[model samples]
Target: MSHFTQLRTKITELEHLVAALADVGYATVETHDEARPLRGYQGDRRRQRAHVIVRRQHVGAASNDLGFERQEDGTFRAWISEYDVRELGAGWLGRVEARYAYHATRATLARQGFSVAREETDRDGTVRLVLTRQATGF
Candidate 1:
C-alpha cells in the first residue's frame, strides 16, 4: 500500500522553497492557499493536504505528485510516497534539503553584500562554502 510520509524541513518562504526546488531541477506547483489532496498509486485521494506539489514528470505514465505541507512554526514538511522516493534515488530528501540550504545560504550572503570566495563539495556531497564580505571605501 502506497502512502504519503511527512518529512520535516526548515523551509519557510514559499519563494525560496520554490526556487530551491527549481535550483535542484524539480518541477513544483505552489498551492499554499488552496490545499490539494495527495493521491495514491490507485488514484485515490488521501487525507493529507499539500501546500506545494512536487511533480515527477517521468514517473511511469501517470505522473506522481509529492505534497509539501506548512507547519505552524513556519517550517515545511513533505509528504511523498515511498515508491517515488526510491525511484527518485536514495537520500532524495537529504539531497533536496542540502540544495535548498545551499541556495538559501547563497541568497542570504548576497543580501548581506557577501560573495562566495570558495566552494568545495566533498566526496560525500557535503558542501563547504567560503563567503567574503565586500569592502566599502570611506
Candidate 2:
C-alpha cells in the first residue's frame, strides 16, 4: 500500500485496536469522539466530541486517552495513547493508536487556531505536513 494509504489503514486499525483493548482489558477507553459537520458553513465545517468509556478498571469517567502538545508553529503532535497506556494498559497498539490521535488532534487544533501548512508524501513514501500558529483571535 502507498504510504498515505498505509498510514490511513494503520490509523483505522489502531482506532479499533484501541476500543478492542478497552473491551479486553489491554487499556481503558477514555474519550472516543466522532467529529462531524454540525451546521452550514463556507467550507466543510466539522467538530468532534468526546465519547467517554473505560476498561472496567477506572472508577471515574475521563477524557481522551491521548495528549497533545503544541509545537513551535502551533502544530500539536503526540502519541497520546501511550500517555493513557501508562495510566491504563497499552501494548503494541499504543503506537498505532497514536497515529489516529494525531489526525484528530490536527483537525481540532486547526479549528482552535493552528493551520496545516502543507501535506505531502516523502521520498520514502511517508507522509508529512506542516502546521503554523497564527493569531486566530484576530
For each candidate in turn, give its C-alpha RMSD to the true structure in angstroms: 2.5, 17.2
Query: What C-alpha lDDT values do all the predictions have?
Result: 0.76, 0.39
For model 1, the superposed segments whose C-alpha errors exceed 4 Å read 56-63, 117-123
- Across 28-108, the per-residue lDDT of candidate 1 in tens digits comes to 465668677877666777898888876545244454577788888989888888787777776777777877787888888
Superposed Cα deviation of residue 53, candidate 2 (Å): 14
Position 7, candidate 2: lDDT: 12
Query: What is the Cα-based lDDT of residue 62 in candidate 1?
Result: 50
TM-scores for every candidate against the unseen true structure: 0.79, 0.26
Which residue pairs of candidate 2 clash?
32-51
